[model samples]
Target: MAIANESRQEEQNMREEHHGAGRYWLIWVLLLVLTAVTVVTGRIHIPTWGLVLALVVATTKGTLVLLYFMHLIDHRGANRLVFAVSILFVVLMLAIPLVDLGTRYRGATPPGSTVSDMQAIDIGADAMEGRFGGGLRKEGKTGEQSGSPRQ
Candidate 1:
């Protein structure tokens, strides 16, 4: 009876090892698929939707890696809590810059102005002739500056 019980326990352990390998393989395949999806989505230009789709795919892949590859799936309590907090901090870091950029005034300077020109304008200086060396200056006129033919 003791020998039989020991054999059964050994068999159960072997079965569990096989099952674990299978689960890891599945997760690996899933990660590969998500990577393909990411590459495909990255090529097509869908404006804001492209960014959103890429983020979703990346997040899915990341979660899979964290849960399975990192062996966090069977873990609970403190481990999960730490991971959740880390994710929160990452999101916060990304979001802060995006929020600042989104709220910036788009019309801060006139279009076609260079970085130095924008800086000069911000400091309340006449950057037009200063940077261009006082050439044949004409506003909204056809030439190298305006590109469009003069009316």
Candidate 2:
């Protein structure tokens, strides 16, 4: 009976070790396939959808790395909650700039209009030209100009 029990225990240990190795190998293959998919998708441009697809692939890869490589999948309760909160903060940081961009008025600045106001400065033009001197100084107009030799 003791011999049989020892043999069974050894078999069980072998099985467990095999199973763990197989699982890690499978995950490695899957990660490689995902990397190939990301490379393929990146090379083929599909306009707006291209960026979206790349982001999806990157997010999937990141999640896989976090779960398997970081050993977060085996963790429970508080560890999972902390990771979830961290993801939420990351999303919030990305979302705030997008929200600001989306809420901005498209027609706020018309093309080829030189009117100086809040809109002109916001649209990235030289709105404070008068205070900074509009153009090149005349040759003999001022005492500072008279000191310089004219070519």
Each model's backbone clash number: 0, 0
- Per-residue lDDT tens digits of candidate 1, residues 1-151? 8657765766576557534488889999999999998888878877756766877788789989998888776555566889999889878887897677556565654544431234333422344434544433345433445323335
Q: Once superposed on the true structure, which residue ranges of model 2 sit more than 4 Å away at CA?
A: 1-19, 108-151
Which prediction has the highest lDDT against the true structure? Answer: 1
The residue pairs found clashing in candidate 1 are none
Number of colliding residue pairs in model 2: 0
Give the least accurate 10-residue stretch of model 1, judged by summed lDDT: 115-124
Kindly list the per-residue Cα lDDT of model 2 for residues 32-109, writing each as its tens digit.
898998888878877646756776677777888888777777655556888899888877886787577556665653
- Residue 28's lDDT within candidate 2 is 82
**Number of the top TM-score candidate:** 1
- By summed lDDT, the worst window of 10 consecutive residues in model 2 runs over 122-131
True-structure lDDT of candidate 2 = 0.65
Flag regions of model 1 displaced more than 4 Å. Answer: 1-19, 108-131, 134-151
